[model samples]
Target: MRFSMHSTLFDPDALPFRRALIAGIACVAAVVAGAMLADQPYLIFAGLAGLVYVGTLTVNCRALAWLVIALQPAALIVPFFPGRPFWWELCALLAWPSLLAYGLVNRRKIEVVAFDRAERWALAALGGYVAVILGTMAYRGVGLRIFGGEQMGGRVYVQQLVLSILPVLMLLAGFSQKQLRMAMITGWLLSLTYIVSELTFARSQDMAPLLYFFELPVDGLNFSTGYDASGVRRFGSLAAVAGAGLSLLWVAAPLRELLGRWLLVTGPLMVALVGLGLGSGYRNVFASAICTLFFLAWVQRFWNPSRVISMVLVGAVMVGGLYFFAKELPLSVQRSVSFFPGIAISPIAKADAATTNSDRVEVLKLAIADSPKYWLFGRGFGMDRFDRLPVDDPNDSVSMLYSQGMFYNGFLGTLLKLGVFGLLCSLLFVWHVSKIALQLGLLVRRRTPSEWSFFDRVCLLLCAQWFAAVLLFYLTNGDVTWWMQSFGLLAGLLMACRRLKQDEGFVVDSDGVPKASVTA
Candidate 1:
């Protein structure tokens, strides 16, 4: 039986609540006393408070969603220093308890689906990997020596367990379609915040102190104005820049009633998109965002043919503009814009854009070569780097000079840690997410005029962008386990929201509220 928060039996203010409150107080007292006796009561109260805060917030999924959205960027920056607990892991720990309590109170059951099964399978594979690591540590009887020791192994083991499993569980436990939109809107707001912060940092001399005062990462902040060795001024990390472009792309494609058709078709919206891409020096991110926009336009072609045509025309113009004005553009912009010169149908041409692709290919080859030796189960986590005998050859130069680690590649890293079986499980998880996203995308496409279509479309766009980011990161940034963990969380939440939408059998109205009747 579902119990509302207002019900006398469930409400904290009611008579029965006093007994429950007394028990809770006793438990808290017992915990505190035990901690004190153990001589480890430090920060216990603070930890308890944090738990209470998260528990309270998660009872409302909307609040939880917003919290998740806000935490995304913070998670990347806050945990920069070593020996610090990850913010998202803490979020997961607190969220699970509250999620369980809410589920018990409301008598909610987990709905089983194909994707959920895939998620479980993935979890099991990860569990097996952990088990192997632990078992090896035990069997070898390794000690606490830090370097290449069991202590380091244990830490790596624990870190992976928490990051890999907790986020997925937290999202799967609680999320709805409304919450999904809330996350997307929050993401957009964050993008705008990034833009504002970058502009401020560039324009103001004293902004560094202000940014530091707000606990933001000052050194890593990129305003897309500084040039690299190649004279390219990349906006930010691949994910950050791609995410910013995604925000602009979502709104750029459709301004339905807010602006005229011509504006949506050929004017300011398109200009903003190009500006965003040019500003972000990341070629992969720009291409990914543009591809996502094109995909969306293609999907909505039946509903909005003019938008599609406009996008095609925009691409042609972009190519031509790059060809004619290649050198006229800023050096940073020219570095990216010059890629179109070869196919621009003009005499003007420039060398193909510079890249680290060769370095990445070398790393991938190394990963491929090492995969077979550890084919069944991997050497264990945190042991991705190795020594190669032929390292002295000047012709065989690679980024990893002293000790070779997989550089700018994650698939190899995954294979190095979890082996072929684990790799399959991870791939299954991706397959499941892709399937659900496509289904949801098709649903939104068919239900043309539905009120929530815009939000759904954005979610679809985000999913595509996410997939692109994954590919980009795998190829160009090996230390993307952070990204993968977060992706797992996002995919789980998205799937959960899709499940809720399917079960509810209704459509959102113009006011952005779900209506009882389903849209045709």
Candidate 2:
């Protein structure tokens, strides 16, 4: 493989045939070498697939961003590696270096957005929180490990932190708003596969064979099915709420534009998505979806007479249908609606809610009592020892402490893990982000619908609603890993939207429908 002095294999402008041939040969060699080294012929296929992926990434750096986005939900369902440092974690770790390499190769000037007062405060608070994390880690003598540890160890904490900050890095690395939107849409679509699988194959027995093919001997893939007191199966997914929010946004305008007058087909599909999400039997997910829909309705100005009548009709039909089938419906579906007035809740649903609420109250009490001890400084990340007791054991204080630290009960978790100082930092972070999101919302509200692109408007609405949901969930059902990453991404999108409005001059005439514009 003789090459010209000016033509290196890694050159972006290298000949296509030469590059492909060299890459193919290298890939084959790697596969053969790996198979020989491992003494496993099956390793060849894995090596080949990995090499191909890497080759594609080298050719298109943006694919790395897409991979990170797609892996959000995938890391939850697919058993890539058993324990810590899952596929998403690995991708996130790679993202920073990949972004840096791309920047170096392209020699593009990195654009820095000026931070406003709120942004500065948010950044400062985030830095303070991180400093506290480090201080605690050092005081506790916890070593930083990037891979393979117990569930709530330092590695997991650091990985979550990395995932949380990834979107900002992507934005700094020059990812465009259109690219992010496409990535999100792709992720949501991919998550639907897992959702559909869960819904269709409710029984573990039926899904066991399929899941087995994806699992390794060391993989601790959880295939447990959740059921309500009435023995009705509940279908939950890692991305259920987020997916539902995105689906609702799509249906609001994007889907309508894509499938004009094809309501018969797309309408049912959207309904199915919303229904599947609500079927998760999680009140938090249901609440988040409702909040998102409400925000969408308000932002889109659905108060027009025609839209009002349509919504009323739809609501009436849905309510009437549910009323008739309430008893026959799955308990999970019934529980989802149990919050509304005039809906009859089954005894099972009521008992289940009561029991769960009681347990949560107990956890909250424990968290409150123990929070004072860690008021000045937190117990530190990865301090929770799951091996102290069985995870399911109610007496497991360590497990409860872990949950509290991860924001299982929202701010209480922050208080427990990061102490009062950390709590303040978190509050500041949320406050500033909320302030920015609100300002953006109000800014968009003042503009005529035609002045702003539909994409930008939708992005703002979605981001705002997502952040609002984070606030709400923080009060109770906080999953820091998922929620923090979502917060970072949405925060980045909010910034991107602001940039489009201010920098790109995105304005369309009344006669011209809004289209997506690429942002630098």
Give the candidate number with the greatest TM-score: 2
**Over the stretch 149-222, how does candidate 2's per-residue lDDT look in tens digits?**
44355654566566655545544534566776676666666554554445434545666555522322110122
lDDT of each: 0.51, 0.57
Model 1 lDDT vs. the true structure?
Answer: 0.51
Worst 10 residues of 2 by lDDT: 213-222
- For model 2, the superposed segments whose C-alpha errors exceed 4 Å read 1-61, 75-80, 84-87, 102-108, 111-121, 141-152, 196-230, 238-242, 245-273, 301-325, 340-343, 384-408, 442-447, 450-454, 481-483, 506-520
Q: Could you estimate the TM-score for every candidate? A: 0.67, 0.72
Instruction: Return the lDDT, model 2, position 13.
Output: 71
lDDT of 2: 0.57
Per-residue lDDT tens digits for candidate 1, residues 1-520, read 8866667656877877778888888798787767685565545666666667755753654355456555555423323334444455555545556566665665534343233453455455545544655554454343334454533334445555555544345445455556566665665555444444454555577665443312222223533333432344444433354465546556444434322445554455555556555545445545665555555544444226775576578668866766676666554455545445263321221222433345566666766676786667654544322333224453443545212344456666656655666556565656656555555555555454335455665655655655665565566555523444536566755555555655656564322233454656
Give the clash count for each candidate: 0, 1
